[model samples]
Target: MRELTIDWTALHSAFQMNMPEVRCFLSVEDGKVQKLPPGDPNLATVRADPQHFIPIDAIPSRIQYQWLDDFIKALEDSVVRERMEAAINGKGAFRRFKDILLTLPDERRRWFEYRDQKMRERIVEWVREQAIVPLNEAPWSADLPEGSPPYVSAHIDEDSLGNLA
Candidate 1:
């Protein structure tokens, strides 16, 4: 089989959004979240005030949990871990692991951040070893011909994740 290229950003986004029903809100001025001030306008007032509104994308979305570490940590039952570890070592889909993390909101966030950092480190190492330009910060031409291709991209799929495991 050919070595699969990874789109790390998309993978991150996929994992970060583990909470199917919850949406985290962040402060507009700072990237991190901020508490609504006391006596602050209510949701209705905020909706009426353009200054209080910001595009949803402007808010930092949740960071994705990493299957390697986050999934293991989020598991409540040891039997599940054993099965998961076995699956990870062998050929299997990651669906079960994600199912285990779905209900543990706090643990999910914690593990996500932890594993995400490690995932990033792994990406950086791969970049250095391969001498490839990073997708996040690549040196691209400011002035380019129309319809030019992007400078760099690294896409990963389920098959790639299985191989990485």
Candidate 2:
């Protein structure tokens, strides 16, 4: 496995973005994330050379929803938890959840931290699956507990629904 120092924030942004007309890639040689819009000349070249450019798959909405569900479950306040549970049932769950969080500053901060930790774990797993070791220190470098559940879901193409989280 090759080791590369990556820009963690850029990589995280790339992972979070999902658009039909745009594609993201990470340079295996340099670990820089590139967002290629439709019709870009480099798109074909990058697609042709998998060894040098690895496509960055967006984190699926189901995984993100699961994170929200998990966070809601951990909340101690029944009223807030009930509201969040109600918010996640249908199509606009992500936006609705954010709206609720916006009113609660402390809980919103906690949610961001929780989400970031989950995202970091997912990123680490992804790089390892690609046979690449991240050389830079991750925000959460501690070993995940044994038998941690994997967050795998089929891709949900719903760009019209807006951001997943």
Candidate 3:
């Protein structure tokens, strides 16, 4: 089975929440509240396709309004709370993410951004390094023959030879 792991360092700058913990935000619309999912689009967009980048005007009106309401209300109540709530409502996922990202302590946020950027740079460097290795390199240890210089040195005692025989 493949185990799933998360790089929560990105999340702290992105989510404004404790690392490696599940955080939920409630979405409010027309004064009614509902639970939002952890990976809701309003908060995080892991994979971006052209379709996902649809602007607020391009997105269905109902989704846009509900998201704005939830995000705005949460912002009014508490910045942290607002982020969490916006994350849930499936509205303003990117903008809400950007807003929460802006609310972070300047130094800490800058550090996080730097760290994330560095990680990407390092990953690219690593991939480039790996690409240069020859694919056909021998994968096994040397297999020495009997009486070869290496084999003779490896077995100084007659008993070792007898054992192998």
lDDT of 1 at 4: 29
User: What order do candidates take by lDDT, descending?
Assistant: 2, 1, 3
Best by TM-score: 2
Q: Write down the TM-score of every candidate.
A: 0.31, 0.78, 0.22
lDDT of 1 by residue, 8-107 (tens): 4443343344444332232222322222333555544544543333212211222222346445644666875666556444333355555655765654
lDDT of 3 by residue, 1-165 (tens): 111122222312223333333432211111111223456664453223222221111223454445434434423337565555655456456565555666666423443443333333332233233232212211110222454432111212222222221
Q: How well is each residue in 1-165 modelled by candidate 2, as lDDT tens digits?
A: 998888777888887786857899999988899899999999999999999999998888899999899889878899999999999999999999999999999788778767766777688779889887777765334333334333221222222112334
Write down the worst ten-residue block by lDDT for model 1: 54-63
Q: lDDT, candidate 3, residue 155? A: 16
- Stretches of model 2 off by over 4 angstroms after superposition: 18-20, 139-165
Q: Name model 3 segments beyond 4 Å from true.
A: 1-82, 88-91, 107-111, 114-122, 125-130, 133-165
Q: Global CA lDDT of candidate 1, please?
A: 0.40
What ranking of all candidate models by TM-score puts the best one first? Answer: 2, 1, 3
